[model samples]
Target: MDFEDACDIAEDLQFDLSGEELIDAYRERADAMVPGEPGRAVFLGYLGEFLAMAGRPEETRCLRGGGA
Candidate 1:
């Protein structure tokens, strides 16, 4: 999906899900995703940023990654 879609979903997730519900929904979507090409990596990056900014009052589900 695109940045706007990701942001919209994040907003929905924040509003509707929490704890196990959030984690399960995240896993369901994540497991069903198609791997993007390298050029499309930026969208994945923006998704985490949007999730962080989406105001999840329960807990943050986004994790961090860095250079090996």
Candidate 2:
């Protein structure tokens, strides 16, 4: 799916996920995107930034733990 679609999904699901799970879900979606696609890096970067802003350190830690 495209970045915008992913963002929409994230927004829709934000309330349903634990902060950590939300970040994990976004990271998974970002990773599944094809490399070199326009906005791929930006999408992932923004998700990471958002997670940090949301104080989701456990989520960020899991992402890092997965080596993404």
Report RMSD (Å) for each prediction in the order shown.
6.4, 4.6
Instruction: Using TM-score, give the best candidate's number.
Output: 2
Q: Model 1 — TM-score against the truth?
A: 0.49
The candidate that wins on lDDT is 2
Model 1, 1-68: lDDT tens digits are 76566556755775887765665665455445666633234334434444556664222343344322
lDDT of each: 0.52, 0.66
Please give the range of 10 consecutive residues that has the lowest summed lDDT in model 2.
59-68
lDDT (Cα, tens digit) per residue for candidate 2, span 4-49? 7656676775777766676677677678778766445545665777
What global local distance difference test value does model 2 have?
A: 0.66
**Least accurate 10 contiguous residues by lDDT in model 1:** 59-68
